[model samples]
Target chain A: MNQEIRDGLRAAVPVIISAAPFGVLFGALAVDNGLSVFEAVTMSATVFAGASQMVGIELFGQSIAPWLIVFSVFAVNFRHVLYSAAIGRRMVSFTPLQKGLSFFLLTDPQFAIAEARYEAGHRLTFRWYATSGLALYVFWIAETWLGALFGRLLPDSHALGLDFLLTIYFLGLVMSFRKRALWLPVVLASSVASIIAFNVVGSPWHVSLGALAGILVAAAAPLEGVREDEANEGRADA
Target chain B: MSDGTTLLVILGAALATFATRAGGHLVLSRFRSIHPRVEAGLNAVPAAVLTTIVAPAAFNGGVAELGALAVAALASLRFGMTTLFAAGAVTLIGLRALGL
Candidate 1:
């Protein structure tokens, strides 16, 4: 293997390990939410954002407006905007088309590892990026297919807590960001607001309403003595 | 929903997500800097949005589920993603098996 390809695959190993469960879980959960195996695989292949895909499948089960589901997916994935902005600067030699393709694979860990690479004084090569990204892409699709097939064979989803696994998964995702600024207040506000919204407004609305409450609190919080760019880096392994 | 609709929603979401991934370079890069508040809001997006997904589930869960979440949260403070997730899964399954 070429050096760039080798390095890229190496960089992706940890990410592949961490993300493996979610890939399979999303597949099973997608089927649980009524997606066909093909659709589940299609989602893994195309959308490729784990959390947003989960949000998409969750909403798919609720009979919410399709646009709203798409919107929720968009909202969940909005963080990629920052990632793109931050990582774009490091892709100095990438052609416009290469940059477009590169951005498509820009998941959380992709961004972090690439940024880490850049910060460590290496040139971010297209070969390196493509190797890592495609390795993840192939595994994601394969796992989704496996999970879908496995999900089909399961007799009782409830007994095994398949319905609640995503909840635990989501909780794990939330906890991963505990080191970020305003993490506690943001979580508390969103949690309280979502619970209230779940009671008053209902299922789908809580996601948006609760998220808005938390974002507003964080944005409006006093910035006195706080470093401006402190929020920029993290594992973001999800 | 029809398969067609499901496919459509998935495609739409992919497009929107792609725009975000590409948009920052196309649009936001033109700006020299981002407002601190805007940055903070963006920073909060993952935790805030993910919390909404988790909180409602925790609120509606039975004791086993809640215990699992509590254990997961504590484990998160000291552990990596896989360990914390496994800890929660084990706790949840064990509690539910004991008829929690």
Candidate 2:
């Protein structure tokens, strides 16, 4: 294997390992919520993002219109736009095919690793990111299937309090951000907005409002020469 | 929903997600440099987006949510993602087991 690919896999292990519980959680949630095991596995393989899939499944359970569910998934995943923008500038010379595949496998973890490397002066080639991203892709897909099958065996994941895994998972994801001066205000603004929006707007739309709130705060954040959020992008959680 | 319906939704989600993933480069890669402010916004978005989900759950939920998130948040900042996750899961499971 290429050494960077090998390094990518090595770097991906922690992320893959960390995500295992949520994959299982998603699988279990899908089966109980509305989906068959096959559908859950398929979603895991293709959709990849746990939060959106879970929300999709929830909307499915509610018998919401299919079009609305897709829209929600899109809005929740809009963060990938920012993710793609952040890294696209760094990997400007990649072929369209390379960029497509890399982005297809994109998730927060690989982005985190890449951001850290880029900020630290490591100029990564397409293969470095592709190999890393693919590693996470495989791990995530397999775990989703396992969770679906095993969750079926459990009869009621809620009885076991597995439902709480969603909130617990969010804790890890939220806390993964690098602590900085701008972090709290951005978090506070988005979080408050999200709560209000959740009551009025609902799942995916609420997420959009929250993301927009955070982006706006970040854009106009008052500070003097402290580029902390920049240096800290990929520094946390790994 | 039928199996076909579920499959369609999943496909839609996949396509939408893939679109976002590939979108940045398709549109922005032609540009020579990223604006510093855009980078900051992107950098802040992850935490901001996630906090919207987690912070309220921690504050609103009772002992189980509060304990799991509190421990996880502290552990994440100090230990790392995997460890904090383990800590959070353990806390939630323990609290539920104890009827908290």
Candidate 3:
């Protein structure tokens, strides 16, 4: 391939590696969730958001209202809006089509990779962004396909705790918060709100409710000298 | 849901996701500055969402579930993300088998 694709692929290594199992797990679970192979793979291919897709698939299994599923997906993905602004301004020369593709492929790993590279002072290239994004984009779809085909081979994924892997991953994510004082309160507040939302209010709304609580608390908290760049770092999912 | 609705659901989600990704880039491509508070709020989303997923399960889940969560957390911190999964499922199952 060309230099851009290679560079992009190289940069995507950690993301691809980390995401592979999760992708596979998602695929297997999609099957378990009663999605046909076509539907499962298609969702991964098109929707291209892992966590939200998980939410969508779960709601789909429960046969929740489609709009609620869509809403939950939106709620999970709303973070991308903030992600786009952080990375988009850097792609000043990108055409409208590129803009469309950039967001189509906008995801946590690609965003995280690009954010890390740019923050380190490497000049951000549309090529690098596009290539790396595409690398992840394709791998996610392919692996999901593999997962679905082989999903039945695995024992009950939930019984095996496959579902909790992402949650575990996220818990590890909390350790990344170097601002010790801040993260504790944010987590505590989020936990309380999430539990309340999970129990009293409704289903899956807990995820969004908890997250919003964290955001609101974080916004009002004293994060002196906190810059726009710092915000980009923590925006990726586990 | 019918086949059409299922398709619509997927399509709707894809569209909504694409909008979020593209919308911000389209709007912000014209600018150089972002408000620090807005930035901070965005930054907090990931962690907050993560806590939403982890806290509930770890706190409210059964003995096997709780044991699995503890294993996942300790393993992840010690071995790192490269270890690839929560490893809690097996642990949780094992704990249950042991009558924990």
Question: Which candidate's DockQ is highest?
Answer: 2
Task: Report lDDT per candidate.
Answer: 0.81, 0.75, 0.74
Q: In candidate 3 chain A, where is summed lDDT lowest over 10 consecutive residues? A: A229-238
Q: What is the DockQ of each candidate?
A: 0.50, 0.54, 0.45
The list of candidate 2 runs beyond 4 A from truth reads A1-18, A25-39, A57-69, A92-94, A108-128, A147-150, A155-161, A164-176, A179-181, A226-238, B1-9
Candidate 1 per-residue C-alpha lDDT over B39-59 given as tens digits, one digit per residue, 9 for 90 to 100: 677667667767887899888
Backbone clashes in candidate 2 total 0
Tens-digit lDDT track of model 1 for A7-51: 889877756765776787889999999999999999989998887
User: What are the TM-scores, per candidate, against the unseen true structure?
Assistant: 0.67, 0.77, 0.70
lDDT score at residue A196, model 1, on the 0-100 scale: 100
lDDT of 3 at A96: 73
TM-score of chain A of each: 0.67, 0.73, 0.70
The residue ranges of model 3 lying beyond 4 angstroms of the native Cα positions read: A1-36, A51-76, A85-99, A108-132, A147-151, A179-181, A226-238, B1-9, B25-32, B63-80, B83-100
Which residue segments of model 1 deviate by more than 4 Å? A1-40, A49-99, A106-136, A147-151, A227-238, B1-13
Evaluate residue A54 in candidate 1 and report its C-alpha lDDT on the 0 to 100 scale: 88
Q: Report the number of the highest-TM-score candidate.
A: 2
- lDDT of candidate 3 over B1-100, digit per residue (tens): 6767888999999999988888876675454555556666666655676677778777777787777667766776566443524365567667766766
